[model samples]
Target chain A: MNPLLSARKVSFGYGAGDVLRDVSIDLHPGEVTILLGPNGSGKSTLIRILSGVLPSRAGEVLLCGRPPRGYPRREMARLLSVVGQDPPVDFPMTVESFVALGRFPHQGFFGETTPEDRERVRQALAETDLYGLRDRTLSTISAGERQRATVARAIAQGARVMLLDEPTAFLDIRHRVAFYEIVTRMKEACGIAALVASHDLSLCAEYGERIILLAEGTVASQGTPVEVLTPGNVQAAYGLAVSCDRNPATGAIRVTPLRGMPAKNR
Target chain B: MTPRARSEDGRLRPGPVFVLLGFALAASMALSASTGPVAIPPREFLDALLHGGAGTPARVLLSLRLPRAFLGLLVGGALATSGVAFQALLRNPLADPYILGVSGGAAVGALTVALFLSAGASPLLPLCAFFGAALSALAVFLLARRKSGVSPERLILMGVVVGAFLNAVIMLMVTLSPPGRIPGALYWLMGDLGLGTPRRVAVLLPYVAAGVVLLFLLSRGLDLLLLGEQAAFQTGLSVERVKTATYLTASLLAGSVVAVSGLIGFVGLIVPHGARALVGSGHRRLLPAAFLLGGAFLVLSDVIARTASPSGELPVGAVTALAGAPFFLYLLRRNGGKS
Candidate 1:
């Protein structure tokens, strides 16, 4: 099957520095692709490029076989939604109203909310377990709830592909697991594709069907977790010595960095 | 599941609040019309409204008081709407046209036409003011634009710096001008509504209406903007387009008003906050409520400006500052000065 989203030879940079370089990746339908990278490793930049928030300075990005720029903003929004890292909740809007913003792409500038729109928002709220707190202001919600609220917004957009940048950064362990489960269920139930950028190696190993490891704006490796999470690859990508092992109970890859390694070797 | 006393779609019920504000606005207009230098009774006011005449009371009611009151309403509404748009665009609650230096730019435009060109009485004043406001807005955008985007902090800083420099220029012009022109310039600078005429209102109404309608149409986009530019972009909003549209429309609104009624302060800053307090932060509700509440507040302020002294009129700007500055301080204290 054709990839839902694809990037070819994509390169992006700020003045005097590059953030992403000659990076190419594809996200297939109904699959979870985790982008693993350390800080300042171009993960967020790549996600922005894919989401059409930033134009790639070099190369091309296609959404469903068409250039992203070819689509109108509203039309593109309906096809791909992005949950940014730690979106600011400046205005004191209720959780329900905030989620309803997702329906923007589906409606006209002054379009009245139809029954279907309401139903979609309701389903999103329920899916993200935010229905119980629909009336509460976003400022009053916990950090995990806020993250879920943003996810619910993306889900309500009814997009074919979802790009999430460090969505679990503020989420606790329980919510982190819950978030991945929600994404997994979304893929199974709706055939939604997700490209999640994260630094949590274990969580990505647990949830990702495909992992793309990035280091300094380039793809270091791309394969299954067992293939990409090897000691040598991890050490090379992160510039640190690390031991890689499989968890016996869950049979998942686990990476433990050797903290006492010499600076040069690390 | 337990039933809640909310709308089925979770929309805030705004019917009662709108009706109440509408009534308050009508009542304020009536009160403003009835009491002025010459206090006309309600019966006479109604008679003057129904039957046009050339009598003194009829002229005052029809030609002067009625048009001035409506002008107040329009200017107030325009300022308030601009405030809402600017605040949303900048993602800062403290942002308003005057605070962002749009008004200062407009004042310079109007002052230049008035002092040097002697075009104050002509129809060119509003056009000049509009261009001035637009230029100032462009300057702010250019100064605030960074590699990433315009941050709220940088926008405010550039606005204040530019605004201060413009204010200095205005003061210099006032000092250098002929003494006879100083009073008029100072009064205009301080924001007087006495210049209101049916003709000026007719000229300005379309621009103000257009700005307000455009903002109302983009209310949904404005709501998305509250999530910050990045999230707004992800949500299908063209962030740059929306920001540009909002700034230009808001500047148009403020410039039109400033052309007619000099730099009236506080209506823009205070009305949006008041409206938000009444209705929730959703721009759909907030914009209309701000328009209404702002109209009422300005009419009342104009009333105070007319009647505050037995001898002469106070600048409406001064009256608004008297009331608005205290409330602004209180808001700052409440928000812990984060804005």
Candidate 2:
């Protein structure tokens, strides 16, 4: 019933400028939380803080009961995983080997691959539909396939929570939908909580159980999509004229931008 | 279970490749022992081995040729292993063992002992060279580090700067040294295995063993490091700790080898690429593959150095550079725009 991960008034800055200020968020088990914001709106920064990759300038982050940073890196990784924007392609690594890296936290420094580890990797590959391409090197794969590999890696981590930073940025429409479906399946099947940073408003409304809209390094709105995706909120946060309605088929909030309007704060 | 995770590691399958490389290494060692100035025919070589090795051919094989071949194996294996560690640490395939000025520092150390401290071949020369290499490597690491983290770009740049300064020092020492000191200093600089006695091989064995083992243990960590710093950290690798350990261990390997055999170039730079081609990039396999392949490559090069010209032996460094530079250029051309 309680939140699996929570950030309280987390603030972060670089040099003289602040990137995130007074942002608080929570992720519960088996929930799909969509984080929406324009570019440089502190979405990635917040994800980094929540994932313990960056220390918050102020406030705190708690994973389960303790601070995320208090745990050793591997222990923390056992509880949470992250999917970043891009996958590394500098070396020749098969997709299977790349995904198997997620098992590091579970394996000892000198440990051999256990049957369980291999099973997990195989399952992750199968779940992400990467089994066919597992033999191919990362350089030979498409960007969407690479993104899915990142997701597969997180899935293989077997973590309770996942934080994704623009995971669908390079995905085409079908893959974008498939990405959400995979996350949804993971949530339903494993009770894993996921926070996805995205710009796809309609998809977020359709798939995200909760939404946190950020603007100017602050949470402008946090609620169900129908409550937060209003015309006034979108216009204020994005400085664009837009209409908000419901998708007739899915009963999800639909946002449409009006053309030929002189936008403010452009 | 996804077809039981595929039994083989692609077409290369490290087990058989390891066996093949092991045989190649043994054959190269045999050829090296037999092909020196005193050519010991196979029959005589076997007779000496089976007998007490009292004959002249047996003495050359046991006392001179075998020790030098073993030295080549250790030196080549260490350099290639160090190269693998450095490449993983920097997350750059072009990174070599000497990229962080360890070799320059080593050269300075050997030159110092030759020009100022020792009158002749001193036992303390290798020790001094190692300390010099370690000190310069530490200096580069400290210079590159910031509060945020040690960025690979910053580390490489600092290495270049320190290496250049050390080179200047080496030049000044070589230029101003008494004429008698120059030959000893210069020969060491060029790199040779002529000094590979049983004692020298014994002295180097422990260092090479310890360094290679440590690197092998850190193989998984190194594998994660190729994911880049942030991703490696997120994946539960203590990225900074692993990088620091890799830097120190790799420096140790390069430094100790430099002390024993002088500065051997390109074995570190080229062997890992060849090994990677054979076994893919998994460090667990790649490290051993590189070590064996490097051993074979250097011993073969040394064989050519010993017999290529009738006049005298060429420095193995010269041979490696001659072959390695052309291969290096070809690699550069192939990888030009890809990176």
Best prediction by lDDT: 2
Please report, in order, the local distance difference test score of every candidate based on alpha carbons.
0.85, 0.86
- Model 2's A-chain: what TM-score? 0.97
Cα lDDT tens digits, model 2, B174-246, are 8899887656556667778887888889878888899999999999999999888888889999988998888
Lowest lDDT sum, 10 consecutive residues, model 1 chain B, at B3-12
Error of 1 at B24 (Å): 1.3
Residue-level error in angstroms, candidate 2, position B38: 0.9
- Put down candidate 1 lDDT per residue, B1-339, tens digits, no spaces: 566666433444678789989998998888878877677776777788988766688889887888888888999999999999988988777677887889999888877877777644456777788878888978887998998877766787898898898889889878888877644677778888787778877877888889899999888889888998888888889888888888888988998788888888878889998887677888888899999999998988999999989899998999988988887677656555443
**Which stretches of model 2 miss by more than 4 angstroms?**
B1-11, B113-128, B138-161, B175-183, B333-336
Docking class of 1: medium
Model 2 DockQ class: medium
Q: Which ten residues in a row have the lowest lDDT in candidate 1 chain A?
A: A85-94
